[model samples]
Target chain A: MKKTKKVRQEELKKTIEDSPFITDEELAKRFGVSIQTIRLDRMEMSIPELRERIKSVATQEWNETVKALPIEEVIGEVVDLELDERAISILDIKPEHVFSRNNIARGHHLFAQANSLAVAVINDELALTARSSIQFSRQVKLGERVVAKAAVKGEDERGQTIVQVQSFVENEEVFSGTFHMYRSNQ
Target chain B: MKKTKKVRQEELKKTIEDSPFITDEELAKRFGVSIQTIRLDRMEMSIPELRERIKSVATQEWNETVKALPIEEVIGEVVDLELDERAISILDIKPEHVFSRNNIARGHHLFAQANSLAVAVINDELALTARSSIQFSRQVKLGERVVAKAAVKGEDERGQTIVQVQSFVENEEVFSGTFHMYRSNQ
Candidate 1:
């Protein structure tokens, strides 16, 4: 019985190595055990459930490009940031960054990227966006890597932080905006 | 010759209507003209080129619900609008109408929508945004359509118009924003 159990465990690990997406039923059948037993084994191994595994995969893909970077690298590369009382972020638009036939940068991406950069600069573990506003001054076009710059504008008595940011394509300024973020007390 | 041109015109219109994505080569071939000619026609109609057109379609789709209403209806929905000394615009957001995911409304959408509304309210033939500043206060979530109550904030002595606006998503106040719009003297 002990030899059989040991063999089953070895087979389970090998099965996992063969395909990461093994089902509980399949594992149970291979081990001559109940589905619940297979699940327990999975749990003991610190393997997430199906939904969690899928979510982790997606998160991994997303982090591959943007989220994996440290806050400092994100602030510097994605949004050229200038920190002070208020944070300022600048993003330069490139041809590949445009979403419109006119080659203009998409408004949402511009705002979100700038906001993300601003959030990174906050000296806190948890930062939340409270509000924002922006204006598109000129249409950005293809082949233009507009520089987006952000700066800290001010902070309120309640500790809410305000940041100003701008994006420029070519020599022309394309978009300018501002954001407010809140940090929870750790 | 006129009959031939009419046939070509019908074909071109059909291509544009049948598929929102009409390649320049296809259009040129149908019209028996150069790609440049098709481009010129598109420019004359204010239709952005391929990539821009694709982006416009997508963005329009996302904002379709809001844009479906007449401009007058938009004004009726929002309250407390004022023009500043420099013709800048301001608006207020009430908590009920903000997006659920980001408690605060998106900054670009706010600015672009406000700028468009400001243009509609203005006598100028063309209005361009130059700069802006925004601050967010609290989380304004789903079911809240921010009531943008605004006034003209300040005009730089350089003939720029700055508009200040406040927004409340439902009962919780969301954000306050200012926009700078430039109108051609024409």
Candidate 2:
């Protein structure tokens, strides 16, 4: 049976809220409606396009984990963070991040993902790196999504914190780093 | 006495070649000519605008330091590089690099600049960061220009190469890092 317009719109809104990155085409396919209908429904509901939704989510969720620095300063999107414990961020490599000659991602992009996560996990208001050791296990290509996880190991005698960050693409480790951090109190 | 158009144009070309980041306003002031005249001379000489010129120089100079990894992977424009010795890069913080509310640059951008410079200074094609220690000395604002310098310290007993990278904004140190790099041979 064909659902009513109100019911369909409500469902569409729910779907988008659940998965902000879903495309209109995917929504249409899922709803058994045309792409135009999906777009119209989105417009009627005052919902933004996928890109705008992603940006909004990025900004809205940013304040939760970041205290020492603004959310925008984190290299990637911080999806989860527990200060002085653990944190996670996701970086989507775009065309601008790759070499035109080869669709490979720049190594710094990976490093940024891990480095920023390390900084975001610190509990203090001022967190900085005193030293770090990193390894790139593999080359990350363009369009790949790198998920970096940072875990706070412990504190040294000097009160500097140690954080371990590992970045993975499709569950494959691409980069890993151990950072010794300095805080204001420390 | 004022110089001829031909002589002035020749000198303008030399000045830009020496310092690619000079602005049109600065160029006009230096040449005692109108900005329009400087633009016209640049057009006639097929010289690009400041941004394009910077990008061009970055791509051209990138190959000089980067061999193992592609030049596109470097975060900032590599102005100078001496493999396994010293290197320098410049990063201009853009709007996208900062949080929307505050124009302060994200921490990752600084890290990327320093980390990439560290990677580029490695002589080997398969150089990777085995460990790193970094510090954010000050908060970097958007539109600020960061100049990062990387110098090789020495090698450890484990054969890991050490590189020190320091980033400055207007002669003020903003970020610094020490990287332990691993090459394929070592």
Task: Please report, in order, the local distance difference test score of every candidate based on alpha carbons.
Answer: 0.52, 0.79
List model 2 lDDT by residue over A102-146, tens digit each. 566766677777877887899877776666666767777887777
Q: Residue by residue across B45-113, what tens digits does model 1's lDDT show?
A: 666665454344332232222221234423223322222321222233444323333445444445444
True contacts kept of 2: 0.45
DockQ of 1: 0.20
Query: Which is the leading candidate under lDDT?
Result: 2
**Candidate 1: stretches off by over 4 Å:** A1-112, A120-125, A129-139, A149-158, A161-166, A170-180, B1-112, B150-156
Model 2 DockQ vs. reference: 0.22
- Give each prediction's DockQ, rounded to 2 decimals: 0.20, 0.22
Residue A92, candidate 1: how far off, in angstroms? 8.9
